[model samples]
Target: MLHATISGNVVTQSTTATNHSILAFLTSTIGQISPARIRVDNNTVINNSTSGSTRGILVDTPDTSTSPSFDATVTNNSVAIGDSINGVSGLVAQARKASETCTSLSGNTVTFPNGTPSGIQGLRARQADTAVYDLQTSVSCTGTAATVLSCLNPSATTEVLGTINTVSPGTCLLPVTP
Candidate 1:
């Protein structure tokens, strides 16, 4: 799809299998030569499962020779995780090998239940291509959890365009409330 807009929705998932509440992927099949633009905003996502690789929102572009460029914006969404036995994510944007991929995140909130498992990420951005991959975020993003990594596993090609505030231990950057 070239362009899509998804906004103002509430999604709840109760499963033990790997799943994503909101997912968008740009593929190279069917001779998709142009870029893809997707917008996800103002939604509430709830994950009620305690085990699985669950995610609240995910946007991805696969690695292929004829992959199209992608631009996605995710904003003003709320995500709540009941618990996690394995790794889980609130939001993730990944561009494996696209020519150009841009992702922007702003005004999002994520919360995890108390005593949740470790290695839970609130926001994650990854890019693995020689081309440009921009990941931007505003200052209004926030994550609340007891043992969570607010932001995790950002690759070298991912460029974050916002003020980054790091918590203690210096392994993650959580956005400060403004």
Candidate 2:
């Protein structure tokens, strides 16, 4: 759904999405205009087996001269993805500009039963990624395959401030407490 001029919307208690081909469970790709608060909680996103990139939640603002600040809260959600999927990220917040703030993902469970070498980023933030960001119970490699179950995917960006939980099983979560 598009958030052109909408703000302060809360999406909660929703079921899993059958549309797995899209970018994420909740995504906002507003351009220069920054939408208001969007809180997503207590939702379940399961069986997302898209052949392409399938992420859990995404708050994406296109790169501009200045960072478009966004306010989002995602919590208490359960997400599961199928194996053999590529470009799969659990939680992603992309602010390619500067000075963007107030985006948080906490208490969310994400699991990848099937693994892929394409890499699974549990929680990632782009330009605004700083030490202040980290995955809480996010980032778990399931199904026990050495080649696929490697949650040690490193950050390509230099501004990652939080620790990605490169651990295993039953501990997949993310958080950005601002």
Candidate 3:
């Protein structure tokens, strides 16, 4: 059930065993609350299914100036369970591969698959600076090249890895009230 309206200090507890999805877009303009207390657990959110233009539990721009603090307590959810569905991406990509040459990425440095480089920082870093990335399968590899995650697993020898997933901020300006 979609929430009619979520106000300040919302305490939600849901136990849904069904396959349906819940999409709540938390935004900077959602509420007057700077940090909205949110607790989500035990939900199935497939990217292609839970997505319109974005993916699962997206924090977007319905409200850009609200500065809602999103405390996501997501746990125990099945995302990729397309047991009987085929080609479920809804929107068709022109090609199976998406690539773009980013000049800005040159000096950024890359983290190889899930393997951390020697003498580098560990995965347990601050949320503001640390990155959480996943490498999914893409059909852009040669015969020997598998997927980034496949290769990263070490068992899958010589998988073609995509660039370290990076998210440089797009140009967005949230209003600041004096």
Best by lDDT: 1
Please give the range of 10 consecutive residues that has the lowest summed lDDT in model 3.
100-109
Q: Against the true structure, what is each candidate's TM-score?
A: 0.69, 0.50, 0.29
**Over the stretch 71-111, how does candidate 1's per-residue lDDT look in tens digits?**
67777788777765654767776766545665656567777
Name the best candidate (by TM-score).
1
**lDDT (CA) for every model shown?**
0.60, 0.42, 0.24
Candidate 1 at 17: error in angstroms?
4.6
Give the alpha carbon lDDT tens digit for every residue of 89-131 in model 2: 6656554444343544455566565753355555555444331
Off by over 4 Å in 3: 1-20, 28-32, 45-56, 59-62, 81-178
Number of clashing residue pairs, candidate 2: 9
Error of 2 at 159 (Å): 11
Superposed by TM-score, candidate 2 places the C-alpha of residue 164 at a distance from the truth, in angstroms, of 13
Please give, for residues 54-129, the per-residue lDDT of candidate 3 as tens digits.
Answer: 2222222233334333332222222321212221211110101111111010101112232322332211101111
- lDDT at residue 145 of model 1 (Cα atoms): 21
